[model samples]
Target: MPVLDKFNMVSQGAAGNLCWACVGWSVARYYDNRAGVPPRWSTLCEYVMKAADFLDGISPESTRCCDGERLLDPDCNQSRILPDAFRVSSNQGSVRERALSFQEIKTEIDAGRPVGVEVESSSAGSRAIAIYGYDDSESQKVMVGDPAPDAPDGALIPYDELCFGYRHSDATWNHSYLTVP
Candidate 1:
């Protein structure tokens, strides 16, 4: 058998949404194939977070948070989260991260980095976006910063019918993004 071109997700986890996981793996694969070196799941996840922080010159140690609660803790006061935060179990598949605002994830894409975040919508299913690039909103039209060339659904989903959760929409059906204002 031919070695699969993409990393096979040995197991799928029971979580809110996994599209983000696919997005994460997409970035991992890119580095694996193009960068000539890649980070492990744990390290790759961190690199993604660091890329996000590069915008503000923050370090992983400064932004690391195990969970949303910790990330929001006054003491931790973290601005970022780890893929581990989404991991339901070390034995199971990777967990997906929470949805962050567009502004929160802009820089990573601007720098050619991939980051995951949940996006809210009325549609059913878990959803995550791999932020790739952003269009100047000043143009009066929204443009996507699509990093994953093969994302299941075309990037730039508008809110309204978008709902997130691993099975919110059947994986196949979910790819048909419903756009709204």
Candidate 2:
């Protein structure tokens, strides 16, 4: 399986509304790994914030979160808005359809791709995170890159715990995950 190199987790800092920072970091890490370069976490975060507004057609507010549907829109103007260097081909689906299953997540990881998942967060309400690795040993877990200020980078969360968060009924988008191709 391919593991992301030169990847580092970053804090969302004072921008509490930018939960999509995880998504940005995941996409940035994917491109950085492909280019075999060191991570540019802050720069990528800037681009991600702009891209989110373009995709969602609204600037993120303190009380609102970015929409997953808009981010995964295949026909959106990603090419026009995102720098050519940051552009990527992707696929997405709903958790209710088994699209975010453990096998599917592992498949992406094995292919050197990161998966962006929407999950419920007690600390920040609804949140997004990137899943970059899977461990199937006695204690199965998925490696995650989270942007919450208090979250640690490369946290190896149990698969079941991730599932609970991803499938949490109270989350803003209880169904979506965007996958890199």
Candidate 3:
């Protein structure tokens, strides 16, 4: 009956029906609420991501401060108003290694399910994102991305390449845990 409940239901689905966008919005919402983590949704289409906006909206200060790449420090040294999840991992493998991996991402992909990518790499400009969907079965290249109209450019990357930036190979973000009360 609630958005979080709906998100939980969708997350529980067999891999093909995961609905990653909802998951992304929900998880980001959770982090924003619980840990004061900033929103990772596209700035270009902030209005469209209403739920995420509600969790962490863009403003002049938050904009320069909260960008996904910059939020990695839990202390948020750069940002005067620090977010909780920012420095939670600190170069360690993502907390996600307990579950979610290439094989798991593949299962979700084969089923047309959505997956969330929680990667943090200086090479990647230091940011985390929610992969909308992926095509891991492709022979040479696997496609992973979100469909948000205003997402950043150059979003897609080879599936094999996606795992390195993260702290864990098996971490998949779950949004139901992210609802804003």
Scored by lDDT, the top model is 2
Q: Judged by lDDT relative to the true structure, which candidate is superior, 1 or 3?
A: 1
> For model 1, what is the C-alpha lDDT against the true structure?
0.35
CA lDDT scores, all candidates in order: 0.35, 0.55, 0.33
Predicted candidate 3 versus true structure: per-residue lDDT over 89-120, tens digit per residue: 11111234322555655554444333344443
- Judged by whole-model lDDT over C-alpha atoms, candidate 2 comes out at 0.55
Clash counts per candidate, in order, are 19, 0, 13
Arrange candidates, best TM-score first: 2, 1, 3
Candidate 1 ranges with C-alpha deviation above 4 Å: 1-20, 38-104, 121-123, 137-181
Is 1 or 3 the stronger prediction by TM-score? 1
Supply the global lDDT for candidate 3.
Answer: 0.33
Clashing residue pairs in candidate 2 (N, C-alpha, C atoms within 3 angstroms): none
TM-score per candidate:
0.35, 0.62, 0.34
Q: Write the per-residue lDDT of candidate 2 for residues 1-181, one digit (tens) a residue.
A: 3356545555655455555644655576666667777655435444454555545554644212224422323222232311222332233322342336677777777766676666654654666677778888667688888877778888887777777654353433244454443
Quick one: how many clashes does candidate 2 have?
Answer: 0
For residues 1-181, write the lDDT of model 1, one tens digit per residue: 1111233221112222233444444445544544566444453244334444443455656755235212222322222222432231111223333333445335444444444444443563334443344444442111232223343333344322122333244332122211110
- What range of 10 consecutive residues in model 3 has the weakest lDDT sum? 1-10
